[model samples]
Target chain A: MIGATRHYEIDIDKVDHMSKQLTEEEKSQIYDDIKEFLSEELDVPADQITPQSKIIDDLNGDSMIYLELVEMFKKRFDVNVEVRLIGQYFQRHPIYTVGETAQAVYDIVERGDNLLADEDKASV
Target chain B: MDQGIELVELSALTAPGVEIALIDIERHPHLEDAADQFLEPDERARFVTLRSPHRRREWLAARVCAKLLAARKGLIAGPHEARIAQDRSGRPALVDPAGRAVTGITDCSLSHKGRFACACLGRPPIARVGIDIETVSPRLRSLRDAFVNPSDAMEFHVDTDADLALLWSLKEAYSKAIGAGLHIGLKNITSNRNPATNSLRVRTLAGRVAHARHVVYSNCVVAVCFIAQ
Candidate 1:
């Protein structure tokens, strides 16, 4: 599960603007890691996925599958990915290419990691 | 209130043979303080039940729903006899006791707002059922889009406040009725009023679930969903 966060470091601009609340590099790493993890988990070829792979249409991912992917990311990254965020992204943007997904992943990771880290440091 | 009752009766179409029970948790005494005894032994073993007042309300609501279901059907009921479990996203469900495969699917939904809690129960022979109720609050101004689809947004053109609340209730009810994770994405489903059919069409990318027979009582909006046998 932590494989995604460990795999690649992401760039800031690849993230969705509305979710640009976190660091660019952390987001980029998470995005690359998730795509790698997903490609492996889904048994789809790795090269088939890019920074913009559409989760549903291209990878043939379903809602439940996306959720499982998110859970794995959370397990790996130790971040709280609200279920509502998935809906927000799917509703707001249904882009299914790997590049698109990678971008989305970057946004989520950066925003998510920062929030988790802040909350963690605060509690300490 | 009369319209609300009619809506409830219509939503009752979800379960044909199974008995239905409705209870207001606010009416039950000591409900707000029974968190300890309310937990199932299994849950107690796992140490998941928290002592928060909100959890107490949820437990009380679950217990009350189970008890009412048992009483109405004349079945033996025990503490947590309904056998509740949550989906991956923590949505609640009641296990069917019939063991007959057909009898163990107890359909239910719970909603709480302010000091009140409400639940709806149905079973197979009865398709799927979900119900949601929420108190009207001014705070909803910021949460309207969180509840409705683009189509339903039209019907809400007038009383935006109540409309938003109703849509929110429908979203909860749909989630419960489907008994799936919130991943289904409330946006996937669209709601629209058909003036010709006088029924609310609740649709997803494919087809429709139950109709949104609207019912409101007090300061709450109650939406029920059910498929007829």
Candidate 2:
């Protein structure tokens, strides 16, 4: 039920991405949040989770859990990017592991409303 | 076979061309009691890989439901002969020992509630099938905004938590039938209720219509939905 509110308008100009990138501290924070979220949701130990741990094979995760993570970031960062576009991006370039998903969340937050822009393709 | 065939008549819960079977996990024997009776070696191997004990129970219950139905329908030599494997998209299928999808079973869906799990199957010409079970409680009432929209239902009158739970199950079933689950966004799968019969005319934004039959069994809302190819 998280990320229930899908309809939101983010003025791309007012996003104020602070030069449109994530700082090192911000990256670490994102990783920490992911660790906590997956640990709590999947009921796995936080220590066992790694950036390279596969969500499905390693952490016993399904797509719905990943969708919850997306909704959590949407509310926490207030970056209401298009979830459908991200879903399509996921289809084209799937993120399998913990670190890849963290990087995707960072991109989703940093890119804000332009997550689907041609130039903003997720590296993973 | 007794478990599945007997429950098919539990309710009039039926779609046009699909068959469904329910498993009351609370009443069924434990996995430790009879896992080998149903689960194949490879199936047991996959089961051992699941870490969470709660998830393992649900997974075993769902597979039992699917396998019982498949065995009763003569789709397999027995329960252990087929495996209900989920693809990367998270859509489950009835597959043979060699890892290929089985014939006469175009789609197979598994859903689990607190103590109940249901499996549904449909053949070719029917593109997909999905089944879901959810308890009707205050929890569903609190998450109104998550599943329902202003444009979703006009005169449907979602005046009770049970009604809202039905809506949520309908959406979940349709999402599974389409192989997207909640990844496609909850709002994308919409429905208009047939207030008289309580059946739903569910549709997606892509204009795909699925027929769903809903029934309330032992405080759980169950839905089975399917679409034509």
lDDT of each: 0.54, 0.73
TM-score of chain B of each: 0.73, 0.89
- Expressed as tens digits, the lDDT of each residue in A21-102 for candidate 2 is 6678777877988888888867789999999887866776755567668767767666666556677657656798999999
TM per model? 0.57, 0.78
User: Candidate 2 DockQ score?
Assistant: 0.19
lDDT digits (tens) for residues B20-89 of candidate 1? 3344555555654453444455544433333334445554555455544543454434434444555655
Q: Residue B72 lDDT in model 1?
A: 42
Count of residue pairs whose backbone atoms collide, per candidate: 20, 0
Quote the RMSD, in angstroms, for model 2.
Answer: 5.0
Can you tell me which runs of candidate 1 are displaced by over 4 Å? A1-85, A88-124, B1-22, B32-39, B43-48, B75-81, B96-106, B194-197
**lDDT (10s digit) by residue, model 2, range B1-229:** 3333233433566555577888766666555456666677777898787755556667777787788777777888787678877787767888988888887888889887666778888876777888888778765553465457666667345768787778878888988887874447666677876778866778877758888888898888898788887
Question: What DockQ score does model 1 reach against the true complex?
Answer: 0.08
Question: Once model 2 is optimally superposed onto the true structure by TM-score, how far is the C-alpha of residue B107 displaced, in angstroms?
Answer: 1.8
Question: What root-mean-square deviation over C-alphas does model 1 reach?
Answer: 14.4
